[model samples]
Target: MAQKSIRYNYFLNIFRIGFGILAGLFTMPYINRVIGVEGLGKVEYVNSIIAYFVLFSALGIPMYGIRETANRRDNLKEKSKLVIELLSILFVTSLVSYLIIFFVIINIHSLLDLKPLIVIMSSTIFFSNIGIEWFYQGIEDQRYITIRFIIVRIISLILLFLLVKEPKDYLNYGIIVVLSSVGGNIFNILYLKKHLSFKGFTIKDLNFKRHLKPILTIFVASISVSIYVQLDVLMLGSLKGSTSVGYYVMANKLIRFTIIFIVTLGSVLLPRLSYLISNDKEQYVVYVKKSLNYFLIIAFPFTVIFLTLAEDFTLLLGGQEFLPSIITMKILSPIIIIVSIAYFIGYLILYPQGKENIYTIAVIISAIISVIANFFLIPILGHIGAAIIAVSSELVGVLIMILLYYKELSKLELISVNILYYIIASFIMFLTIFFISYFNIDPLVNIVISSILGFLSFFLFLFIMKEEIFLSIVLDLKSRLNQN
Candidate 1:
């Protein structure tokens, strides 16, 4: 297999995420108006509930498998044995997860009403196991992953618009959402033979016990993270009814959509970092430093723009029915920076270094704080409280991660002086966009004009300042273009 440059992988990932944003821009407003808040809320409510089962079925394999597979990427025989063992484990966990989903739906009175939707969405659990996306990610196969995703996403979007014509069609919307999210996974098995094989691997060669401790450790951390992440939706549905969940979902989705760009580098580098940890420690450190710098440069600007233009974005994406989500979006805007720093530290640093136990501890503490805060806050403040807790909880997790690993993190010089440059540029960009907001214009047109001027002004200022990172990127793109 051929290896791609980090720049190439990053481009593919960005393209993939960019297409998703385009799809959402087209679909969200349509879905929001067609389904209305309560109807959309009902689908989200069930989706949130089903996400727990999906999380458990994963059993942390998504993270653990990628690291473990990258470690053996050069040795196909060993990789095959490892993947087989992990799949066997995954099969059992997924079966158990689905069974539990079935049991809960029948046993719980409230869920009975959602039984049909729950069952429809539950197909994701089975598809996830077959996806084996970890193997391709381990080998850094960005081309296949990106292509498959775009194809499935396009199909899913077409289906969503066609089938989900009204509020009552929310069930159709639920199934379409599930397919859009995980449908690409179904193609993974078809592509497996080129990279993975079970030929020389015997059942007895598998050592499931060897993986249990680490997998369980990561699994616990995942559960903790989900508490603060997914539990807000679940709790909102339980306390304030599905309508509140709907509002929070809109804001949360919008915020998370932007976060995909911030975290794209981390996802691309996870396998690379895992590989470098054992083979090239010096380059690994360099990549970590560069990764953090890149994260901050993008995160700062994105946070400022989103904060200033939250209303335009909410109106543009979700329309007037979701106007309430604008405040939530503003409150959650800073999460782009928070999550960027945390992702670099946790996924790029600790997990690759086999320090997930430490990562687990950080998130567990954050989860405890989040749960206590949500219980007291959600009833009084509703979606706003959830938004506040979401930011604070993530901030707490990142703080603990930094504090616990301060001695190690300090030596890397993750905080670059270029941060000052990025901050100044973002400030200039914010002024540009903020000024544009006062002019009378259509929301979509305002966003277009604001984004164009804002980014041009941003880069114009950075160029004037002669920022090293920006210059390096410009030179790198020029070099690539010249070579081509």
Candidate 2:
């Protein structure tokens, strides 16, 4: 069962990466040509604000749902009962969220001029909160989730090409997002239907009081995570202009793609880790060490490449108008690497131990630091300042979390070998890129060549270090190919 989950996760990661690349390639030109940097920034700012509301609407149900389902996996009837109860909770929460957004929009309508767009986009929150995919995630049904995402992306790309015409078409873009999100939810619902009948499901069996404490804790934790994650763009728009917001957002989006890859790995490991931690502490430690080692190995080299190629990547994806964000991208790349590790450790190691309050406190501290940084930085440095603030705040948060994690789980060892390998590989990759770029090569070509060399050098370093995680991955792939 564990092996199946791992394989499923591997496939989903590949699917997600491919989908991201295609979506980026197709949508970048459309967005850049139509809305331009400033327009894109405005959209991003609004979306970021909406994202917080979305997080509120979610109330961390997905996390709670997965944990519940995993714990009750042996009893199908109990699992179904839990699912029905969770779905009921989400339904009420989502409706309340929708109403809150409506009232907020109505009250701030004159100030923000976000009436129709916010109204249309609010449906996404409700649809996404239906908790359909939570079941699949709990059972490790990655194939279904991956297929649904791929189809949604493909259809959304078609809509973008067919409908989006000019800068003013931002309204249409928002509508398309709402529509695509609904379509994805519908697919998830149908997929869920195939696994269980909702005919006899009821809320009567739910242990609401028993779960209330944990649910509220998860909610607070989710809000804290959302604040640090989404508040920067919101604050950036308010402090600086939307165009400045847009440049920083574009850079942040690209960095987020990197973080998504790492998060995918974390998502795959979390349920298993949660289950293992309850049953076998020693085994859980082994899994945590293995997962963290893998994360460092993959994330360090990518961070180096992102820092090296930030300028070229920004220019290629967002065009010359967004050239100012080059520095922002470079500054934030390493932060994403750190954030990826922090997220993995928090979800898989800390939260499962019922230490969500510690995680929440860490995120709150980071949020406060982020708010301060943005207040000071935006006036002077603009979007670049936003990026700097983001990176610094995340670093501070992760450092605190690491200390807390050690305090909570004193048995877990920080593997010095993993840290040493990552640092050495990152240094080598950074130097390789520096030399390549210093030779007066064309920026685009230099980025490509440097990226190739950086990747190769990183992998070679890992190989020389005899990293068991990398070796295990290699052997697994070879064995799968041989079987095929």
Candidate 3:
């Protein structure tokens, strides 16, 4: 039953992430065509500006909430109290963040034109509190999250096509962007009634005092992390203009999209790992090992494929006019593995163990590196420079985290023979795809064929090398077939 539940969480997130990426890939070119490069850039620019506010509104509640809620899931009253208190805190903080946003928009001379879109985008802050995404995540009841986000995204996608018909419909497109996230948040609020009663809970029951310090600590860490993240788009928009922002956004989007497959595992596993740490160290160790192995098996190939087929991927996803993103995507591709490693180290380990200070230090230093690098590079290389800084900074942060937590991390013995198998598989797959693509064909067709052939070769190499993940999947399939 436990295994089944864990698999359920993993696969639902897989469905949501997979669906979101596939849907975006299908719709992006059309959306870009309608919006125009500059228009798309403007949209990305505004969204990037709003992301900081969104981050501030979020603070550390999501992570902190997940841990606290998961620990208290059995006691309905305690869980309810945590939810209300966290929501109250979230509400107050989001309002404060929104006020800051309002002030910035009004005071900044360049942002006046985007005042409307910025306001509309800011609606997400309000929804962020009501969403209580942490509550559901804590319980590992991701079916609701999966269904809600997937349904909302699909609706937004349809609305995007129907309403956003031209470049002038940038505002309409902006509405779709807000709907993508906020729509589900509304559902999350409505869903809360089924689980807990707000009417019975008073403000007196909410304990905001206890959570304040840790939450703020995580918030500062979040801000530092967001610095490097949103800095790319913000700098591009400010220094290089909207067209450059557009190209950079596309590349960043592609990298993020590809990362879903890798990161989703670590994300869904966090709560379980936290629980297992005290009660089941053996399982926890196994999960850590498996996460690392799966990250290599899963993330490595996607990065390699992106690196090798950057041009083809850009043309397929962004159209010919935005081919400048090809280089950015290539430069950013390898970060996939790095990001997975960072999450495994920072989130799965240090975070669950209450090492937020060390985590914060690592990310803050990383953000500083990003800022300095961007100052030097964005002016000279533009968006490509942003890509380089983002990747390099993450690498630095991961290294710092490893160094700080050397005693704990070293015991895990993350290096293994499976890693060599993954590398061998990925290398062989890359060669196969490279040779096949030499035929000179349609970009889309080339991508499709290369991915299929490359993945097949990857699987073949894994099987030959007896990779654990591949063997486990094969065995699981056999078990299911026999049961059927």
- The candidate 1 region of ten consecutive residues with least summed lDDT is 257-266
Clash count of each predicted structure: 0, 1, 0
TM-score against truth, every candidate: 0.98, 0.93, 0.97
What are the Cα lDDT values of the candidates? 0.89, 0.76, 0.85
RMSD of every candidate to native, in Å, equals 1.2, 2.3, 1.7
Positional deviation of 152 in candidate 2, in angstroms?
1.0
TM-score of 1: 0.98
- Candidate 3 per-residue lDDT, tens place, 354-409, comes to 88888899999999999999999999999999999999998999999989999988
C-alpha lDDT (0 to 100) for residue 216 of candidate 3: 85
Worst 10 residues of 3 by lDDT: 1-10
Best by lDDT: 1
Ten-residue segment with the worst summed lDDT in candidate 2? Answer: 1-10
> Runs in model 1 with CA error above 4 Å?
none
Error of 3 at 68 (Å): 0.8
Error of 2 at 134 (Å): 2.3
* lDDT winner between candidates 2 and 3: 3
Taking the tens digit of each residue's C-alpha lDDT, what string does model 2 give over 83-143?
Answer: 7777777788788877787778768744357676677777677677763666777777777
TM-score ranking, best first: 1, 3, 2
